[model samples]
Target: MRSLAPQREETAMHDHRTLGRELDLFDTDPLIGSGLPYWLPDGATVRHTLEEYVRDVERRAGYHHVYSPVLGKRELYEISGHWTHYSDDMFPPMDVGSDQVVLRPSLCPHHALIFRARPRSHRDLPLRIAELGGMYRSELSGVLGGLTRVRSIHLNDAHVFCTPDQVADEATAALDLIRRAHTAMGITPVRHRLSLPAPGGKYVDDPDLWRRSTALLTEVLDRSGLPYETAEGEAAFYGPKIDVQIADRAGRQTTLSTVQVDLHQPQRFDLHHIGPDGARHRPVMIHRSIIGSVERAVAHLIEQHGGAFPAWLAPTQIAVLPVTPDQHDHARALVRRCADLGLRAHLSDARRGTLGARIRQARLVPYQAVLGAREVGDDHLALRLRDGRRLDPAPADQVLAHVKDLVGAHRTDLW
Candidate 1:
């Protein structure tokens, strides 16, 4: 329980997993391994929105996205030191007949190899490579919870290869990206922790390298003026890192983003770039993630908003409901119009029940378009919001404009 925002004295009436079931978001089945979850249509919609958002952010930050195999050779981890230091958390290696491989627990090693695949110059310094990398870990069943703790994970991971001089700037840029991403999603990182290696610890045993990396990170954080706490013996085995802690509405702070500075991996992988003086120099590596994983971020969001996602991120932004079977044609027409306008809209057939019942059920959708005789005849939409606010009927173009504004602004409120 790190210092976080104040929690409401009133308890949350519904947990995320329960809301997830009600909303048809995601579920876990014993048939499918213990910690794995199946993302239903609604859940996949949210996950896709998250993935698209991170990819766009990374792209704007000059990151090159790549896709790699989920499984890697066991020797790859041996070179990266995960074999010695992190094997306990990794799944057992699979025997592929003359070759042994394991589902990658992280994307750092693979990105290191990508950086080393070609000859690079000092001009190529600050190469930022990113991916929505899928990873697997062997956590004990007892510790597994819904989406928060699972065997499979899809990480918004990136690695920056830069010269020693560029470490501070690169790290600061990564911090900016993290801040922008969280702000876009209406999440606030309560504080940052500078995780450092403990003395005589299991971390990479190079004291000089540790001192250099830690000092560089401190300088960057100081320059940025972001207050942070230093935690002893909390550094990753490879290097020091900055962990961004986000507090949910319940006042529980979780580390959902990280910016780590690593100097050893380049040496381990023999990565090099030609410097200004025409000499080969090893590059420093920065590992970062804006959103650690799709599952955890969405889980936190589900609970934070209580299943009422923002207009732009909602699975169904607008629900179209007709008054009777005769009005179905009008409802269907409006659904098509909304789709053409780039809105996620679905038709909730009025044959199901009364307007009150449909409105109640459409609470899951951000906006409900009630198409009765007058609305259909006038080519207007009767909009009802999840917050129980009803809007006057507006022409099709007017409604489209409002929804576009919400989507463009990524607004959480109904207009």
Candidate 2:
């Protein structure tokens, strides 16, 4: 906790855009068009790890993962009200003979179709569907910067369909998941926002629907006892939302996670589940994102940690730098041991630079094992932690156990 202020200062000095280029994490090619950045091998490794973490969390929380199309029929968006409320942010429709398809701007419409694919009963109430999906938004080039504001997004998105009576509980649970995800990634939300529609804002026309959904989320926030501020014109077009806000390097607040209570979408799609009494009833749709977009989340993470990510999240967790050519075989053997222990370890280029320079070069790595001629066996390999602490040579089994425990537990400590 004491390191928070200093770390944020470090983040401000180490903007992700600059680090991305220097670290070879990700980049934008002019041929790929603006607002679309390609992830390098290292960047993809981090993104894949984050996605895996999100999947594990969602699964434990009773959400079933799904894969949906990135393109949807034009009528699909129209039926979901996106055509009317959000078409401006969406790409132009692509014509295919008599029909047209558009790049999806959100996952809910497809998830909604999944819910309606087969008749569901009350037993299936609170059906939670999750996806690490790709979507696109047509942003003006000027507004696009790095990964934070991109056209292509791989989102950590989920939807919960439950009875109206269960909305509050589901929303609370969703908030908990979001908090856990943030903490795992070393992010702290500076504030929580209850986003509502503004005067004459483009929202669902039904007064009762808006009122009910807003009160539901407001009560959940109040019951959770987390202080929040209400923001006008900051909500989704279909409903009000509780946004988890974090400040970026420039100290500008951006929403990273959100839980939105929606009544309009289910109604628009005419979605329903059969009650225990055999009557058709509307199921409330609660849309939530733990870490909204992979690109934006990684952007925040890179800046927040200054690319010195916590042990579990570091793309290359450890670098094995052999001090001399004589120790080359020893270094290769140690890297294999690390791989066997599930650590991402790479042998640094001992051929290119001096040993001291190589150690300094891998500063972003969470751990470094520098094996020299004197350090003959795997059992006596010394460690240099990222925070500049040096560990004396210890038994290889004991050392690997401790390091593996920390990484496996997703901990920050490197002892």
Candidate 3:
């Protein structure tokens, strides 16, 4: 029995499929193909909430949101150096008359074209563009997990174009944004890694530029007081990058976000802006993603919270259960009140199962459940918090007010 205890505990902690089934969050259908997710209704709500959060954050940071097509002409990749450098990661190109089209693996080149849509001056330097864009990559079929690795990803992608003088400041500001996002989501602080190119490898082939870029990134980390590991030769072909890694409950580290400085892309794309001296000069590019992808972030959140989402982010903030058929009307009214207060709530009919069974089911998925009943002549609701605390019978308005505060305050874990 003692030896069996450890195995049972391990099974309880690492069982993601159990959480997925219990919460009715997501599932994959064979008919839909592998590496694809069929998001259940509740799962879609969670995804949308994350998207809104990122979009709002980006807007406040002075980033102009833009939309680009999922497919691009083959020639675009040719000029962007992706064809030669990252061909293995891209999806197969499609023949459309004389032009070949391929699904966009990244948004940099498309955003560059947007920058060139019109002429720009030094005033337009430090232009930040953001996109909650969907991209496709031909990932190896065997490596695909639920949401961690997917063929289609709605990336919280952004790029900043700025002058040489503004590089450090822009990088710092981007880091600040990412920190705020992680803090809000209750994600653990991540270890930063400074990713540089390997010596004598397929880097940008400019040693001076690599050294300068690495120095700038190192300075930013120092000024921010962020502890980081420097990985030699791990940089992208175009620039040095900062990879933010977070540890899961099992202590496996995964990259939650990244910020990269690119000095090569602007030159490759011939991107330039009018300088203060009225001359066309190249602009540097910085690419960043706070959460990386909506799907993967959702998966991480589930694992982090052990499938018990915070009130604000939960698909169903509160579940109302009636103790008897006589209390069904009161429970329904309570659900309506929750909805009016902008909380997601539902009423579970008492006829379905025993009170203990219903409570156990709700608690297993781990949502906050309320039990309404009539002990005396008047009506009241009992609050069962996710953390196992039970509140005395309270009036509907009082109950609604408390739940509203909990959700608004983002107190999902505490309750």
Candidate 4:
């Protein structure tokens, strides 16, 4: 459970909302209503980079990426226990052709259907299905301010349909992936929390199910070798979860990644897989998110890096600035070569001002290829990094190759 600290100015220097505006990452318009921010070109670049990176990671981890409709029939949520237990946070159902349909608040129901779409064998155990898709929440206008709390959320959601025996390993692997992702994005979680069901909350009325789920999550956490707190009443309605908590600029903690053990959804959806004994056996449902909501993740990242993202995630990886119009031809060649390496390198216009001014303009860019008359004659580039480190002049091709290598490897080092 995250303790919400009232939005304060303590450490407001890195507030995502402020940086978001300054960086032109995203914005909200009244015509679009509250809690919905549109991504600018730069923001979209950051988002697309993140989405591709997540897909690549999941592909290597045996996860089958999927796309499901954002709207599902009302009956789907009814059977998934969402209609009965979570309608307060859901949009009202709309009547369409004598059938009620609504925006989906979660992707689990759809993934469950995909799992049940075909009969499976024990060999297919731990079938990982992932989606980075949009879902809606009916949040109060008062609590809606920035990207952190939004109505239209694109979640990095996944489900593993595995046998009970495979639960521990799948959950553990999910945690490792989360850590790897955070490290690459320069994010640090505040702590790990084992979230339990609230005693008198709107949960499925199955005490035995809750107890068993809690014990399983407890055991899994115990094996993690990481210290964590047991948060009462923070578990999802369907099961207990392990939450990776992160703090905002105000020191307010929130969940950024999660892994939950769910048996209730399987029972509700009647999900199963065939076993070696030739019997139909129930499959455990493991829900995990490396970066829960893309919006929230980006918001946290904007604050975490103060709009100066790592090379891989930055909108402009390298900004090529020619010291004067005399060096324009050389700078143009450098820009083209960097683009050939598939980098987002920009050539600064001489009209922008002096070399010092252009360098200051691109201060947030991870790499700056500043070419001067001397470097142009020598066929080398003067490289400046965002961290205030300037490397010795090197051949243009050598510097471009090094930048490409760092971006491909998702490294923040300015070697």
Error (Å) of candidate 4 at residue 162 is: 0.2
In the order shown, the candidates' Cα RMSDs to the true structure are 3.0, 3.0, 2.7, 3.1
| Residues 103-132, model 3: lDDT tens digits | 998999999999888898999879999999
Superposition TM-score, candidate 1 onto the true structure: 0.94
Off by over 4 Å in 4: 1-10
Cα TM-score of candidate 2 = 0.96
Clashing pairs in 2: none
Candidate 4 TM-score, true structure as reference: 0.96
Candidate 2 structure quality by residue, lDDT tens digits, 1-415: 4658886667646888888878889999999999999999889889988899899999999999999999999999999999998999999999998999999999999999999999999999899999999999999988999889999999999999999889989999999998888877889999999999998877878889989999999999998999999999999999999999999866889999999999999998999999989899999999999999999999999888888988888888889888878778877888888899988899986797999999989998988988876676544768899899999898766787788998888776676
Error of 2 at 245 (Å): 0.4
Judged by whole-model lDDT over C-alpha atoms, candidate 1 comes out at 0.87
Global lDDT of each candidate: 0.87, 0.90, 0.81, 0.90
The superposed Cα distance between candidate 4 and the true structure at residue 159, in angstroms, equals 0.2
Q: Which of the two candidates, 1 or 2, achieves a greater lDDT against the reference? A: 2
- Ranking, TM-score, top scorer first: 4, 2, 1, 3
Task: Please give, for residues 172-212, the per-residue lDDT of candidate 1 as tens digits.
Answer: 99899888877767677789999998877778888899999
Displacement of the residue 179 alpha carbon in candidate 4, Å: 0.6
What's the residue-level lDDT of 91 in candidate 4? 93
**Tens digit of lDDT per residue, candidate 4, span 255-317?**
999999998999999998899999999999999999999999999999988889988999999
Clashing residue pairs found in predicted model 4: none
